[model samples]
Target: MANLQLKAIKKSYDNVNVIHGIDLEIKDGEFVVFVGPSGCGKSTLLRMIAGLEEITQGHLLVDGVDMTHQPATERGIAMVFQSYALYPNMTVRGNLSYPLEVSKRPKAEIKQRVELTAQKLHLNELLDRMPRALSGGQRQRVAIGRAIIREPRIFLFDEPLSNLDAELRLEMRIEIAKLHESLGNTMIYVTHDQLEAMTLADRMVVLRQGVIEQVGAPLALYHNPDNMFVAGFIGSPRINFMAADVVATTVGQVQLRIEELAIDSLIMTVQQRLNEGEKVWLGVRPEHFVSADGADCHFSSTLTFAEHLGHTNYLYVDYDQEKTLVIEQRELEKHTNGDSVTFGINAQQSLLFAQSGERIR
Candidate 1:
């Protein structure tokens, strides 16, 4: 296991700076995930840690040793890429033993290591089969097994599950979690999928445009995002954003009124000062809206469509002239499209952000 520390890590192509100065500490035996959209530089950062990319100006320390200039093999890291990278002509056994053989390990040791890795990944029975004969899940397992055979200090996975189907991805997620528990090695995973990032990471690093947005546990980031981008990016079905204006301000609370979608004024607790008539953004998650039955509706809209996902219901409502609100319901009554529906949200459940797109917590 290895604890990694990156100090002012940066990357640039010619005069174009992609990764700005980034500082992060990854603890030993911990599973950390780097999550962001494409062009956000998550993969580039991962490659830099693996010693595959040069650090423009920073230090890379693994297990208290500086390895910024070390070669990929000398950095004690094993990476499993999006593509399986398996030799189609070679059997699983051959693929597993190749790295060990190349490193000049004894024949007996290589054999033992290959069998042990296969057993750990549940690929023992498929050892004699080529990768072409294996399913996507099986091929991914083989890729993982190849990484495990090295027993590297840290495991780097560059969107390792992106190639599999939804069901296989879920299965492989469980397998990877179990594998981490069994090995207790430091692992770094890179992916744009927020669901995978939420489920697999002990701590997640949310990146945007090659810079760190927020770093915390999955639930922590979900419940308490530091900025507007983090709150909107982490949640599913997307969070609803409404333009709001400050109507009044008290000692501990501020009264707000919707700007675009005209609505009743609501008071929310605020530690930050809000000037009267100042514009701010109001964010409410889909799950926060409750069914409005014979009561005042804070949000009134026309039902555009409804989607049922087994236990949960998603209701898309068109509000005002252009705003669309998605309401999440648990036990929703049947309603046709174009039917009028009203939903309400508690003031405390909503978030306030400044015009600059920063949370006003």
Candidate 2:
């Protein structure tokens, strides 16, 4: 296991910058995920760390050694790509031992490494099968086994589950999580899927448009996002945002006007620097919006749509002013598509963002 550190890293193509300066310190044996939308530079940053892309500036260190100028093989890193990248004609054993063979390890050592990796990845039974004979998930496991046979100090995965079906993806995700637990090596995963990142990562780095938006544990980022972007991007069904005006500000409370509903004087214990009459954004997660009353913030709206999701339901409501809000409900009562509903939110659970899309507190 090795700690990886990137300091002021930057990447450019023909003088046009794609990845801005980024600094991150990944602890040894930690699993960190880079998550963002497509074209957001998550993959570019991962490739740079893998030595597949040139570092325009700054330092890349692995285990306290500078490796910015090193070749991919010399960096002691292994990568599993989204495409599987397995040789079509090669058997599973051949594929797993290819890297070791290239490194000129003894034949007996290569065989032992391949056998161990195959066993660890649950591919021992399929060792002699060709890539075409394996299922998508099996092929992916073989790809991972190939990386494991290399005995790399760090493992890098670039959207490795994107090509699998939903059920297969879930199964592979569990397997990967278990593999990380068993290996306990430094692993960096890059993906656009928020749920995958939330479930698999020890900590996550959120990026947007070549810039770092926020970095935190999954629950921490979900509960306390730095801005509207991070809050909206990190959650399933996304957090609901509403335009509101600050009606009053006191020492420990602030009044807000949401469309026609007024949150009459809510207490905010956190010290927030905000001026009077500022237009701020109010964010409420779907699960945080409740059906009961007695909340600091309450509103009544018409249900535009309701999706019955077996265990729970998602209610999409529209205010009189035409702003839409999503609410997640458990033990949901049957309601028509356009039924009127009232939702409540605890002020402490609500988030306030400034006019510039930054979280106010």
Query: Which predicted model would earn the best lDDT?
Result: 1
Per-residue C-alpha lDDT of model 2 across residues 16-130, encoded as one tens digit per residue: 9998999999999999999998899999999999999999999999989999999998999999999999999899989988888888899999988888888888888999999
Q: Spell out the clash pairs found in candidate 2.
A: none
* lDDT for residue 44 in candidate 2, whole number 0-100: 93
C-alpha RMSD in Å of predicted model 1 compared with the true structure:
1.4
RMSD in Å for all candidates: 1.4, 1.4
lDDT of each: 0.90, 0.88
Write candidate 1's Cα lDDT for 240-306 as tens digits: 9888888999888888888555674678899978899899988899998876653233666789999
Instruction: Kindly report which residue pairs in candidate 1 clash with one another.
Output: none
TM-score of 1: 0.97
